[model samples]
Target: MTALFDVILPVFLVVGFGYLVCWRRWLTEVAVDGVMRFAQNFALPVLLFGAIARLDLGANYNPLLLLAFYSGALLSFALGTGLSFYWLRRPIEDAIAIGFVCLFSNSLLLGVPITERAYGPEAMLGNFTIISVHSPLLYTFGITAMEFARARGQNLSVGGVALRALSGVLHTPLVIGILGGFAMNLLTQAGLVMPEGFWAAVRMMSSAALPAALFGLGGVLYRYRPEGEARAIAMCCCISLLLHPAVTFGLGRIFALNLAEMRSAVVTAAMPPGVNAYLFAALYGVAKRVSASAVLVATGLSMLTVWFWLAALP
Candidate 1:
């Protein structure tokens, strides 16, 4: 019980408080979006950067764990794509979107924060291990798949599409944070000490990242409404909330992940679909309806499912 209160209660309380206030009109949608952006673009990067720059990351490195994590993610992606194409009879573009909806975990906004709150901040190192590759790999695959779908009727250059996809990877703030932090870590390893004041400033912003993210998450839920085909939304939610985590856990065991890695991987897998998926869908003009509905449904229900998984974790 003490562990429950200490580990899990704080996370949900902040999230519930965020929802309550948003529902009560204490925070506007614009305000929430601003806070989310502030956290994602600036605070999260600083926090992650400081983490890598200061920590002795080599002590916990696990290449096998990464292999296991990716195996699970790829399996989920393939399953979702197959189901979307065959079961739902969606177009190629929509099927890729469905696969991404399953594969792209909300690692930053909800996964890292919740894992930190539940297990402790060090758990986030494992998360960083996962997120470092998550975006670049999955986004590239999704974009390339979408490009191929778009090629059916147009004179689309595959190399050009691949270039655009890679550009997206470069432009992502989280990826920049990982790369920058890695460079700093290398410098630290080479005997360059990070300044006390600079670390402090970054820490200050980093401290607010979790709370602001939780608030923004709740606000997003409050404002979100499901539309379009209910069947598609339901299928995507199942893949996001259930199948992904199950496969992650199974693969973790098979790949012999340590306790921390297993927990981190499974928890991240269980998080709702990334909110950015809707943006991609909207931009590409495919699966927008299903993506929007999936985020809302998976996020809302994850309030319960997340806790269940945390409690179930050994």
Candidate 2:
């Protein structure tokens, strides 16, 4: 219990502090937006770049681990979309947005800190590996689905849809960082070494990634107050917090993943929908309320759900 609290509370407390600041009007919404922009576009990307650049890709890039985590994410997306569209009677676009909420977990903000606290820095290999392709893969899938849905009865061709999806994925700051890191990694393999001073600057920025992002995230969620769509919100929370991790766990066991691999897969799978989830909805102007509310509600519920998963993990 102490360990669980240690792993979870500090993260949430920082998030809570940001919420309090926003709730009290200590910072304007514009200020909060600036903070998030800095964190997401600059600090967090640099962190990913550093992590990926220094990663021993040959040793840590486990296909089985990736399979378990991503398979669960895709499954959750399908279920969330199908249920929202068919059962909940949402518009096709809205269904796609809600599915994105289930698809993109808070892998960086919540997953990294919790897993690091529970295991150690060495365990980050799996997390970073997953993160490297995470945004690109999921965003591509989500965008393709959304474009297809939107393009129905329009004159848009299949190639046009694929091109737009690919364009969107490539334009992401996170994906740019990952691609740059991979390029750097390759250069390093070719006997290139970055200077210590350069790394020092990278570390400085990387250090601010999580705290700044988490705090800004709280403020962002404050704006997205839980309004209507109670049923859809509840479904998103369940799928993101419970079902996704369960599927990852089952797959991990089937693949005989080692303890570190299992922990990384399940913990990352278990994170609430990321701020990106809401961003995706906002970008498309569909189901924004549901996406935003899911991020807010699911994050609050993750405190207990993450603990349960940690305890249940082998």
Best by TM-score: 2
Model 1, 49-117: lDDT tens per residue? 777666567765688767776776777778888988999999888888878888787877778878887
Instruction: List TM-scores for all candidates, in order.
Output: 0.90, 0.98
- Runs of candidate 1 with Cα error greater than 4 angstroms are 1-9, 55-57, 153-157
Question: Candidate 2's error at 167, in angstroms?
Answer: 0.8
Pairs that collide in candidate 2 are none
> Which regions of candidate 2 are displaced past 4 Å?
none
Q: After aligning candidate 2 to the native by TM-score, how far in Å is the CA of 236 from where it should be?
A: 0.6
Q: Per-residue CA lDDT of candidate 2, range 51-155, in tens?
A: 999989899898999999999999999999999999999999999999999999999998999999888888888899899989999999999999999999999
lDDT of each: 0.79, 0.94
Model 2 TM:
0.98
Error of 2 at 234 (Å): 0.9
